[model samples]
Target: MRLRRRTFLQGTAAATAAGLYAPAVLAQAKFKVAGIHASPVENAWNSRLHGAMQEAAAEGKIDYVFSEGVSGTDYGRAMRDYCEQGVDLVVGEAYAVESEAREIAGQYPDVGFLMGSSSGPAGENFGTFGTWNHEAAYLAGMLAAPMSQSGVFGAVGAIPIPEVNMLINGFRAGVTRVRPDAKHLIGFIGTFFDPPKAREAGLAQIDAGADILFGERIGTADAAKERGIKAIGSLIDYTPRYPETVFANAMWYFSPLLMAAVADKQAGTPTGRDYTPYCLMKEGGNDIEFAPDMVPEDAIGPMEEVRAAIKAGTFEVPVDMSEPT
Candidate 1:
């Protein structure tokens, strides 16, 4: 579906207005959850987290609050503020301030911290998670391979980090799996939220003979739309926004991880474990979004088989962290 950036919630005000913070039962009112986001809520990554919290709040499972635009220097402070406010669970990404966030968690032994980071579990209360949606991306790549007429694919990403790299590599592997001689043109905008830069990179790639694009960044869809080319989306579903251009997406569902974290907090257990497994395809953490009109009818059955293999644990989508040039 299409995600409207403007409707995205910011923090406390947004949560309450959306009626996403009411307690389901009297006993469930004790658990409070807060998210500290370094990026705007509209960002695909953060939006996944925000959407999950909203779902939880709507179910009266947790009292959810969030803070957006949290910088590296202020991340620790934001976590501390939530903890001080008696929030039971604090969620965020610590890619820029890993040490500071872990230190804050150490100071608050009772509060649970689930963050997105490249690191592993730290203290008794601190844990990290990744989107781990490479399988879905690989599926997207398989779909994109046959649709590409130029035999060249392009991908524009937020950064060259492992999380982004894995998806790119997965997509690449899918493309090569189908079109053994296909060439990939990749670019990184260097920042997570720069649509203009993503578009520029996409345009450059298109100029260099790419008929399809892996839009790991925001503006790639726009570029594809302008050029009348096919696109595969990542992290979030963009079919609603670019129904005519984007045919498939590798979507990350943060709800599974969020629910697991809440369960741990309710059980009086610390959430200091790598929750990446909760983000796997089998855990309902990730999936591929297909636009039927844009997909070839002949490819449908095979894609479903691939998805079945993944969910049945009969197939494994490799996790490649190597940078895609």
Candidate 2:
């Protein structure tokens, strides 16, 4: 009888150890996270946002509500919809609906608001964050300058905003570092999702002696591929689609950053600041990736050297975007 009782107690103990009877088990339920994008998932930036959400979900059960391709009036409505649904966190890119989001956040003070933006939030209930994407852009420019046979580079930008301008300036800096005389031809597409317009601008730059291109919009890389020029991709790597044409890509990892914010808010230490979370080689925020199949084997060694130097603080690439064009 004692042995039987011991066995039963051991079983109970094992179950308790496995959290089968913990009251907090039910209390620690999965939270819902909603992401509202300024553009569709077909674009790299939005796709990365979705990817981050998925990654967070895999770690813990997270229900994701995505409102993709939303802008202006629709964006505000979408925020309201997420709040009405009683989601724990509403994550969105605030570049398009900054003011509208701020107004909506004012109404739903309980809901946590996190934005991927260059601008900051006006209230304590909201927080804004963006990656220091300029570092990756500069690295991409470094790759392009040496590989460009035409001695010219091109950038297809979405808008003239500071975010886009910084990337253009970073790319120019990278090229200038290696090839100081290299000329950069830039085009602003005005809209982030306009693929045809972005393509046209890319082609025009190519015609103007830009043999190497950095693509920002949805179809900019496609334009570079069609023109038989090498392209550096932004936000996410597109080398899988155009192995030969895409030389390198600047990748963004937004999942960990967003999850950190959500966890902080849940812990009651919410940061009410509009800050650019620039990821460098040390922080693992942003990094450059080369096409495994297309990039020349000999170039990899030197690139790794530069990457390591940057990470080690020995090689500081000039990041000043205010330099005169």
Candidate 3:
């Protein structure tokens, strides 16, 4: 009876240890994040979010899954499915399904929702952010001003949405800062992922004597490359793809914002806050990149002055969301 009692005690202790170990292991499981893209992952805007999530996952920060080519009409459904799957956070563009997305967030109050939106946050978890790359776009335009041989710059945008307008306006504002008489020809393709339409609009602008094309959309570089003129790229670097055609790029980095959201989730204090400030230059959200050999030597100094001022919080890039006519 003594030996049996000792054996039973040892067995009970081992089972208790096993139970505790299992719980500890489960507690260390990575957070699951899901992204739903309105366009392909390769698209300009989605790529930023996709790349950020990829980087985070690679660094063992979170377990990330994404579904691309989700349309506006299907956005709410995607959100619901992901929420039902018990994802910790959902990230995507919510400009189209703002109302529906907010309603879904209300249903899943435990899960955090962060999206690219023009409006404010909703409830406790529906956070919103902007594309706030206007500062970088301004620098891109400054670089393009000297390259414009015809004194005419062309900007091709996905839509006349507030953020889109703000970005284009920033670029034009930078250009006119240098060349006061510079004329701009602008067009909106009415869709976000239609590169062919963007290219067509760019071609029209080029035909109208637009010497430097500001490609807020992807295919504008094709027009610039074909026309043998300089162009400015948005969201991603097109210089590698277009060689000498794309001289500068207005880049938006989403990693800082993602990490912030992850931190909030880990702290269990996630809130429906506007994360737009995380998209600013000082916050490592956006910046400009240019091929040193492509940009004129004279344009570098002024652009750097503005860049420095932006980082130093002295010079402010105006956010003009009014429709750019």
Q: Please provide TM-scores, in order, for all candidate models, with all chains considered together.
A: 0.90, 0.83, 0.89
Tens-place lDDT per residue, model 3, 3-66, is 6988999999999888556533433587888999988888878889999999999998888888
**Winner of 1 and 2 under lDDT:** 1
Worst 10 residues of 1 by lDDT: 19-28
The regions of model 3 sitting more than 4 angstroms off are: 1-28
Index of the highest-lDDT prediction: 3
**In model 3, what are the clashing residue pairs, if there are any?**
none
Order the candidate numbers by lDDT, best to worst: 3, 1, 2
Cα misplacement distance, residue 136 of candidate 3 (Å): 0.4
Clashes of 3: 0
| Structure candidate 2, residue pairs in collision | 132-278
Q: Compare the candidates by TM-score and give the number of the best one.
A: 1
- Model 2 has an lDDT value of 0.76
**Range of the 10 consecutive residues with the lowest summed lDDT in candidate 3:** 19-28
Model 1 ranges off by over 4 Å:
1-28
Encode model 1's per-residue lDDT on 1-325: one tens digit a residue: 5556665545546787544333334224567889999989998889999999989899988878899999888888899877777788899998899888888899999889999998998978898898788999999988888898889999999889998999999999887887899999999888877899899999999999998999999999899999999888998999999989999999999999998988998888889999999988999999998987788877777778989999999999999999998
Give the per-residue Cα lDDT of candidate 2 at 311.
76
